[model samples]
Target chain A: MDAALKKNDKQLTVAEKTLIDTNLLKRISNGDQDAFSELYINYQPRLIKYCSRILKNDVALAADIVDEAMIEIWRSAGSFSGRSQPSTWIHSIARFRLIGYLRKNKELLQDESSEWLNFKDDALLPDEEIVLSERNRDLIKNIGKLSDKHKEVIELVYFRELSIKEIALMLDISENTVKTRMFYARNHLKNILSSLDLTDFG
Target chain B: MNKKQLKKRIPIEALKLLPWYATGWLSPQERGYIQKVLSQYPDFRSLLDAERKMINVVREDKSILDKSCLDATEIRLNKVLEQLSSTNEKNKKASKGVNQGVLVYLSNLVSSCSPKMQYAVIAAVTTVTIALSFAFVAPLLDENNVYYPATSGVKKSNNNLTTLLVGLNIEPTDPRLLKILDENNAKIDAIPSKSGMHHLTLSVKLNATQIKSLLKTLRDNKALFWFAGEEF
Candidate 1:
């Protein structure tokens, strides 16, 4: 489980959190500032991380993008038809903005620098676990080096835990394309990991 | 292929969905398909395990922003909130002006009439206004005025109690939910249905204003109640 899940365990189950998010969106539609604030607090960390990954780990720019997306979310909350999960709806808004930002600044998408490779060893682990964590960090660095198309599919699946259908809708691609990209992305990662002598990793 | 054959072999397209299946994020149909395959082909579990391992590694990378970026985000959010507040204020003001303008326009039109015509117009306006007011506002003040479930078809009976059908967001076992019910002088009349609908009975008869207040309280606690409506 991710940090968000861990946090939710202390307060709400996943189902409860989803219900609360839906209710918050309804309240936000009615000009409820408190509801909006609560939602912002809940989603800010998640959105910032998502946008950062897409924007070549530009955390500052990602924050600005998330803020822009949030304002849009506030204005458009009333029009949201509740057909999808609120998380999906919110992520779609952020993804739309992030894609638009990339369109205007194409160079940012092309810059695959190693500056995004920062990692911290925060947890105490056995020697084997330590080696695994080190290998994991390297894997993350390699993921950063993937092409934008391949990287996005991997990130959406492994990091965000979004359904393939949700990702296809967000990326405006066919589900087949999503699956193909995911396959190629995994193959690419596997090749790189093997090349790095990190064969213990899947 | 037969069903058994299909379960025995994993298609490339289905293999591509292994990551999501490992994450437990696939739709029920997809998940069921994958689960069926995994159950039949035990050795294929290795593929699923591999995907799970990769997921763990990816998630281990906590893509958290630095404190500086988080603080900046907070500042930006506050600015956006201020902008929204101003826009809301502007909308309220514009609506208020429109209302005032309509009243002023009507007053001027009535004033331009002759004295007899003006008196007749005034009498007519007053009669229409009063009739409209009674039509719109009488129910608001009526003691028996309460929300009715559209599907229930039950009307208010002559009693000192009202039933409210509520959908709870919190678990039914939560003590805080009981406390909320107690605060409203309500009790669970029926255990929650599978869909989470709870029938709560207000112990005392409440007037329209009280019901409105109670509904407002229930609606405001969005984290607790998904929905609340009286069963009159």
Candidate 2:
């Protein structure tokens, strides 16, 4: 079994996953259906969460967008220059698809704004896990309140786990600009979280 | 160094990097500086700790969806890819123009060449031992391996030397591809294999510079076919 398949180890390290994904992508380029299936299964959750965060409260649409993005991946598998990690490339596709989905459903998003913070729950999650999830939801709600540019940087850093250079590529900006945006985003997040703690809900 | 210099607080730029450092975004040099500052300044250490906790909080969404979402996604994906695969031949034609967006993969083979390396690459391409391959390095075969000054014609038979693992979806005889190959001094031989795939082999002798030029040429072209080999 692959290390990622071991019972107590559901998560693989970034390097391990990147190595595995890179090999799979190469195989996928050769019209390997099995390799494409493996990529879909591995990336399904992260991309779902990413789209969920970006579009906010649209799980069905998020799922569709991610599905569309995967198909795009299958078609574009040949052009993948090893410039970014496979995961980052996957996220970039999802991000573009998410933008289109968002534009298509802008009105629907505003209608669901109240329910945007309601994340799906799992029985397997513990009490501390529930509290953390709630905190994450609150934080993400505040993230939605940020300027679009600031929100993008923070989301890319925390959700996508992209580095400065990767973020630069995705945004078509410079690495220095990425750093500056990240600095402001973090500061804004700090203020928002602090303010959240002082509200009546706190 | 004086005691005051050693005891000075972390600078503002270093402080600004705390969040980036926590997120593993800093360059190695910046990371090292932040680590040194963290060791010396307890105040900055606490800020770094806060940043770590915040990032952890941001990343804490361990929510995996129910089986229903999975089923839905798989069903939809199958519907889409099945449609795509049925029309795969048609899609391959369109895919060439679709991926032509300005973003090229930022590989070191294209971007990091020093001026001297660039000069050497030009010298090599002009000299053309060009295997300009889609895969691995192979030796130049017989009198057939010739660089065209638009005068020397190519050997057309199975006589061309073959390097295995040239991967791209387009057929070897695509007009655009033939144009690209002719423009350069490279050729591809389409070998049918038992694997139900076009085991297209890029045929030529690879010198260092020709390999680099081939990479640049392939990258500069807006076509979607990608090769999976690492840089030579």
Give the residue spans of candidate 1 off by over 4 A.
A1-12, A102-202, B1-75, B115-232
Residue A95, model 2, lDDT:
57
Best by lDDT: 1
The number of the candidate with the highest TM-score is 1
> How accurately is candidate 2 docked according to DockQ?
0.07
- Candidate 1, residue A55: the lDDT equals 58
Write model 1 residue lDDT over A70-162, tens digit each, in one string.
987887787566655577677667765765575455445342311221111122112222233335424333333456777778878877888
TM-score against native, each model: 0.35, 0.31
Docking class of 1: incorrect
Considering chain A alone, report the TM-score of candidate 2 relative to the true chain A: 0.47
Q: Candidate 2 chain A: minimum summed lDDT over ten consecutive residues — where? A: A116-125
